[model samples]
Target: MMNDEQKTDKKQRLIRKGKKVQEPVNTQLVVNIFEGFTKDERDLTQAHMGAEYFRVMAWIKEEDEQETIGVRSFRGFHQFNERLVFPLDCSSYKYIYIELIKVHSRRDPATSKGTVVMGRAKIRLPPWTSRGKFTSKFNLVGLNSDRCVEIKGYLNLSMQLHRYLER
Candidate 1:
């Protein structure tokens, strides 16, 4: 009969042979939100009357249990060049949801205090792209689905997936 040591060695060999080897993956997702512009200057100006600042929130759509990937605040109505970074794990989630909120200086009678959602945009990860670097532009909308913002606004964004180290 084989000794305990011999049995252990055989078990170890079988375990090693059965286990599938995988390389370590280290990747980062970088997002740059560059600019915001509006054609309806009058409407844009009116909207900014009680606006204190703007806040941007990001999260993964799949595992959205009130958890956020990142949050940023900019103190202006225009020209916000914000940068956000997160770990890149495509298998964990499929899409990233970005929301832009307008923080008012004072509470309006019509609405409650604090921040109000002005618009939102979604970034869909392409399955074919390996490099994972791209630029996109989106239009901002209002609360009412049919009643879009009278202002014709554009939001510029750039997203990249960079590989850092591998083992």
Candidate 2:
């Protein structure tokens, strides 16, 4: 887990990155999480559950809409464990936004700081409606209360929008 200073530094860095560009850069999307069974958990579960998929529900906010977007999808265990990522299909939405925050952490056996991060993603634009690019950073501290094991990341749709609208 990162300290408060670390989180602040990261945000500052991102803001700097956003400001450095001469062309218009879109607002970024952030995603963060602290708790969940790792890939190791899938291996353990496969021994009994016999290869199953898990679904995650994420809350998303687009720049143009007042209502938030709720995305839920099934992910294969092996793919999830290997990639440590969940893909979202947002062809329908004109804009996108996401933020991940930790609710609580327990003190039992004691573990390292939780995984937190900020990510940038590019979704399918037009001709290619199946592929996209995603970049992210991990191991960040909580922004709300300075708690460890929290995750946060964001998406920059303007870059994607530019690429998509380019004709």
Candidate 3:
């Protein structure tokens, strides 16, 4: 019933409203990862850092095709700071796309906490999805008082990472 121009205008207005509701990063939490790694293990981290996008797909018990709940994108990789953060506005989805632009790791056996890490992560939004930032923590676990961390554990944690976005 609407003309092409009117329909386009309506779509644009919806996108603008969604962007207004999106939030960016503000608070942060630091976590410690534990596991021993060899030189080969350290080199493997090179593959973890890059630019990737993750869309949150709904998990259901029935054997039916699940729907996409929402989506988020991030540019990730290993770094001195080892920090990757998403905007507060991107909290609606449970999963995110991690894209690594650059990544590196080290074989140094060092054990410490509260080390400052800096890295950039981006969240991609569909034309209809809202824009915003959400605050979340990178959880970790370690064994004994070792300096090197197990790479498998870190990768697994990211795979199981979930976000509860606010309404």
Candidate 3: tens digits of C-alpha lDDT, residues 1-167? 99999999898888888476544334211111111111133344555433322221112112322322212223322222222333333334433332121112222325243121122122232222333333333322232226543322122112222244444
RMSD of 1: 5.9
TM-scores for every candidate against the unseen true structure = 0.60, 0.21, 0.18
The RMSD (Cα, Å) of candidate 2 is 18.8
- When superposed on Cα atoms, how far off is each prediction in RMSD? 5.9, 18.8, 16.2
Off by over 4 Å in 2: 1-46, 62-159, 162-167
Which candidate wins on lDDT? 1
Candidates in order have lDDT scores of: 0.60, 0.30, 0.29
Give lDDT tens digits, candidate 1, residues 1-167.
99999999898778889687455767666778777543333344455443345556666644431222223333334556777776766556567787666555343435666656666666775342468668888776554535644434557888777776564
Per residue, candidate 2 scores C-alpha lDDT tens digits across 14-117 of 88884654443233222232222212222333443323322222333342322122222123111111112222344354423332321111211143442122
Error of 1 at 159 (Å): 0.5
Error of 3 at 35 (Å): 9.2
What is residue 137's positional error in candidate 1, in angstroms?
A: 1.0
